[model samples]
Target: MTVTDDPVRQQASREATRWLILLQEESDDPEISAEFDAWLAAASVNREAWAQTEKAMGLVARLSPGNTSSWCDSTGGGVDMLRQPRRRIPKRAAWTGSVVALAACVALFFTAPSLLLRLRADAMTGTAETRVLHMADGSEVTLAPGSAVSINNKDGRRSVTLLAGEALFSVVHDPAHPFVVKTGNFTTTDIGTVFDVRRTESGVDVAVRSGRVQVSGGSILAQGRELGAGGGLTASVAGFHADERSAEQVGVWADGLLVANDEPLGQVVARLKPYLSGMVIVPSHLSSQRVSGVYSLTDPGRALEAVVQARQGSVHRYSRWLTILR
Candidate 1:
């Protein structure tokens, strides 16, 4: 049967494609190979998936270079199906169906689950809208614009999953029932405190406003950090940064304020992206510029204008939902 014909098989194929790409990209890294070995040994399905992926790769490798494009076109697929733009192809080889099919599988694997989860989240906010939720356990959570969260209080356990965006959590002190907030691979356990959690492209940002929190995860940045009031951590692909800021300033966005301290323009733009109904594009050149200031989140357009002007840059507005900064 074709991979697409069975959802379970399709998911397995997508996961296999991800591992194959990772192994190929990091072939020189022994750690990655070890991890891949562990993954392969974890389940029989994993081994089967890898075998299927290998067969697909072999099929592409056997194709004559001149006929690769013809094969892809005949299948109504293209080289662009691959989402990894940075992936390099050898100079002599042409686009083939194996690579395109694997890419399609991997792309679906990444997007489908997240989309389904977001649609099923218990609480969610749209662009520029903040929502305050009062839980049955007396805990309060303030969701930022474009954020989504799900709560579970089962068998005397309190758990919250940050599905998307940012939120400020004021968890009630319940020593008998520990409150845990999860985002990506990291988890934050409240030690009777108030904190803000934001999901970024690289990782998660956690800022403590009151009390303390224990953070643990596979990510090096957040593993085993006890953050107290006025303390913050930004975890990203590059690494982690621990900083100090006032508790009131941690989630000032809820008060119509955007605060930044020597933050990259790209990151600042990312923070602003949620509040905006339209897309905000920052060119790579301008993305690296440093910004530090307080802007009005209530009027994101004006705030964006001020940011561009401060960097001696320009903003082009295409519509209410589309903007470009260069």
Candidate 2:
């Protein structure tokens, strides 16, 4: 059953997933396997939870390594980790080099867009991190946290592909070579303008801060649409949506400010996540909640409280590295 179907089973599933992760990480140590067996023998529900958790974690194996039914024979399905060998985790230790960073199943949230971005992005930023890159075509790109991009300035070709997250571009107005930014299905070409392109869960958002831009895509773009300053367009494969937004409101995140205007709470948390030195967990239910606010990107904890509390939710910081919104 899903988490919504049974809360008791949900707790078991969560614990099982945690045990699986720990065993995979410390498989060489026998103590972990013994502890896991003890937990499993303590209750029959634990075995069911383990099986369900393993099935769920199977997806992680596709994205990452060392995830398999053979992670151990702890479940009598693979090599016995207790007999073969897992470590004593120090209290309050860092969760470094674990699946906690880019988990695939927990709450069904993926921090980064895709594993491909990790290998392909010429420039990328980690949690709550931002990067500024000067392209070979005299253009500048500001990448938001949890963002990645591949720059193609070779042979004097001014092209950039935003692999993930959001970016603000400042073009040098090189008519000889039109600066282009591509993300998903949308291609935004600078017509002597500065603009912002953000990749969201639904579509790609292109907004001009100054000058104009010619956006061309599939038939959805209506034959190469053009947007001027204060104009914004959100284009997806199915269609596009156009809106008017002030330049100051377009890419204010570059200045450590986030002005959410009826945006989803999930998107806001995704934006601020890069700034905080931790993870923010927003269940799928609360993710759809609409929110509007002006918060400091520099102070994500306070901002997170403001955003979650406004929606009648509470922020619980389990540690410096993890926060859950409920």
Candidate 3:
């Protein structure tokens, strides 16, 4: 059981753990899905607990011994088809077959989540690659590498969900047809503008490059926040905060550079993930350390080393397949 200070949170965490196991063993069942969804919708705390459980599971897989291939079920059943993904599966398909590769395969799935992302996203980009997708409604979107989005145009309105990474959106102004970008708990409705939306581990970030945007969500954004050119805001679970940046500085990652201005070390590493070939293991303490610097996305390996080194941390590259940030 997860013994948290709050009793509500503790119970939610325990239920979330149970749901996670059920998902692995019988995820294909529609009844199981409905039950899980109902449980998740029962309370806000349940959603938070589920998110934490998933995060914890990912960490466990990443740090697990590569040679050891144990999982929840000893029979090695559950989610086998999606174990290896194309873009993130580092050129090592010839490893010892099936059972023995379970640990590494599961780790890759948890980290990159290629299968789920593919199923959910209509358009996506691979490592070290960005894509410019032109919407049917004359809007333009520049997807950051390792990013994916699902676009919908219906009922005279346009909707796009940022499934992973970040994206720069240039919407065509049409009051008759609204353009909205949704990520996590927030929905950024473009009031005729170019903007950047990034889905971080903690929450969603909204930045306007030109024109204006209307951000709406729960809590701080319950009343909606309007941002004009050069305006920025970060809405995290911890709370909402103002993080303003110049128009010129927003969406710089599309230009193949990671411009970190008082950003967390983990955020910096996350931005560079698309260009990196494999997984990066960043310690919690080191990841939370504040960092500020401009790093090159074209040469992500060196950039990662620089980010970690600035905090007196070391980067250990066991192989191109894994890089550990201490």
The prediction achieving the highest lDDT against the true structure is: 3
Predicted candidate 3 versus true structure: per-residue lDDT over 1-326, tens digit per residue: 12224688767877887776556545457898899888988998998787766665553211222232334343444333324446333212222233344565556565658878998999998888899999887899999888999988867769999998889999998897789899988899999999999888878998999999998888767898899999999897678877668898889888878888888999788878778877788899998999998887877777887888899988764334566777
Decide which is better by lDDT, 2 or 3.
Answer: 3
- Across 76-192, the per-residue lDDT of candidate 1 in tens digits comes to 444532333566554223334445554565556545655776777998887789999998899999999888998898898899999889999998999888999989888889999
What C-alpha root-mean-square deviation, in Å, does candidate 3 show against the real structure? 17.6
In candidate 3, residue 200 scores what lDDT?
84
> Could you tell me how far off, in angstroms, the CA of residue 49 lies in candidate 3 after the best superposition?
42
Q: What tens digits encode model 2's per-residue C-alpha lDDT throughout 262-284?
A: 98999888878767765668999
Measured by TM-score, the strongest candidate is 3
Alpha carbon lDDT at 235, candidate 2 = 85
**Model 2: residue 132 alpha-carbon error in angstroms:** 1.0
Residue 320 alpha-carbon offset, candidate 1, angstroms: 3.6
TM-score order, best first, reads: 3, 2, 1
- TM-score to native of every candidate shown: 0.63, 0.65, 0.67
lDDT of each: 0.76, 0.75, 0.77
Off by over 4 Å in 3: 1-112
lDDT of 1: 0.76
lDDT of 3 at 122: 96
